[model samples]
Target: MLKQKAGTRSPDLTVVEMRRALAQRIKLLAEKPGEHPTAIPGLSLYHRTTPTPCFRASYEPGLSIFVQGRKRILLGGTEYLCDDSSFLLSSIDVPAQSQILEASEKTPLLSIFLRLDLPTVREVLSRDDIPESPPSTHRQGLVAGETTVGLIGAVMRMLELLDTPEDIPFLGALAHREILYRILRTPQAERLRAIATSGDLGQRTARAISWLRENYAKPLHMEDLASTARMGVSTLHHQFRALTAMSPLQYQKQLRLQTARQRMLMDGLDATTAAYEVGYESVSQFSREYSRFFGLPPIRDVKALKNSNTALVSVA
Candidate 1:
């Protein structure tokens, strides 16, 4: 967690004011419940008017700042609570179940999501003035921390740029760098640093994860994955689980299940078709696993999702 500097005055009042200001901006930009992509590259706003059921989703490498309300994210067996005062940082792509815990029509859940730029992170790490943190034995890909005033201010400036289209081409890059630099100053910097540093085991593990994400449909061979990460099979398994909270096989199963759900939901594919498309050889096996993961059969789950979306649209 990021701590306030020594001898510095408490920033409670300033944080509250800035949070309210940021929430107003998000309300103006979002205008409805859902993820809203901004003109600025890699920046997105999220607003939710009501609490939601736990839903499966994939999070990429990014910073998620919760400016209002509350959310719950379940990664593996661990649960993370993100409220107005918290931020969730993901250093690698991982699957999780998330739900909105607090939101209402009067005060919706508001947040910001920004994809991390690897090049910029590496550039910041190259600086000599930055202090180094000792290596952690338990490397986790997803972490939660308290939101700092400096981080909130930087995000507010990023949102301000949306009102000036011309400034985005120039000032946008500066804002991105500033946000990263602010994060790097915090203890959470080690997570980003581990992945950005070349020749690091974390970086190698990230390579293997990237491969899994892109080629989930392909048959997964431990040897191939080990070769991709340039580590022995056992070492790769240990490092992979340490970072992702799941083994390679478990991770691939999640990817397949999630993609299959998407195909069925968006493309009107049937269970059998979607199953085969996502590398599941047997439709029955896919149905069994899908039921276990999502708490409903494939057909029923898709129907529920479609109905929920339709209701949301009608309400809007």
Candidate 2:
């Protein structure tokens, strides 16, 4: 028999305690006055304040878990939202935008992001020791699922590495692997299952998705690209849209615009030049498209980014 809460269905008490513990650990991490640490070696830690709105962007394949706030992401046209009780995963390189919907200064948003390694994910799927269920639901690139005690325990174990940096190099990898294993066994495992195999239609579409991610500015020969993935043009057109909620061309366009924005913000590329480098033949067309996607013209957006950095420097 299971114990029921005052207003909710019965679940294991151990599961409830584990989920609460994960949230507590995350809260403590957020209180630390520095950049949030990441599981990935290359990427810097990231934490933020204020409610942000979704803007066209590229989100690398990763796990995004929140403890105190809620966020909604727009992947192509499909929307996925998660809060304290839920978390999200993306198994493929994806173009999307995300915004924090709930946050405050006192108890600001606390999030943990883990990089996704396709090779590792594939290895896990191929292992005979672990079992993954057959997928039946329509697949989307992003998925949100209810948090579980096993998953929360894995997350807590991951954070426990912060104090023992020496152990992290070896132990962290194991813990991270455990977290992925937990996800693979979760109810939403179907999404990851789809991305894990090369034989499935969804997996084939992901192959083409990865291509656009690395070569966003390259001129696309749709038929040739489809051939590269061993998919026909018509089949690619249909399944790709079903998985990502956008056509290949539309995905590339968003990728180009987001890249141009990043170049301007980080590399000081001027609007027109950045536009040209992103495969835009007409400066006017580029400007119009950029403005439409970002809600600001290139010059204004870049200027605002500079000003924000300046303010941060002034405070520090």
* Candidate that scores best on TM-score: 1
Local distance difference test, candidate 2 = 0.71
225 in model 1: Cα distance from truth in Å? 0.5
Alpha-carbon deviation at 124 in model 2, angstroms: 1.8
Q: Find the 10 residues in a row with the least total lDDT in model 1.
A: 1-10
Q: Report lDDT (CA) for all predictions.
A: 0.84, 0.71
TM-score of each: 0.92, 0.86
Q: How well is each residue in 1-316 modelled by candidate 2, as lDDT tens digits?
A: 2111112335578866776666667666666533565544522233455666555545566777665566677665566766666667776766666666776766566667787776777878788977757655646677776677777788787788877888878987788788889988876778887877769887888889888878878899998889877889999999888777788998899878878888888888998899999999988999999888877788997797677552111000
* Best candidate, lDDT: 1
Once fitted onto the true fold, the runs of candidate 2 whose alpha carbons sit more than 4 angstroms away are 1-16, 30-35, 39-46, 304-316
Instruction: Give lDDT: candidate 1, residue 112.
Output: 89
Which window of ten consecutive residues has the lowest lDDT sum in model 2? 1-10
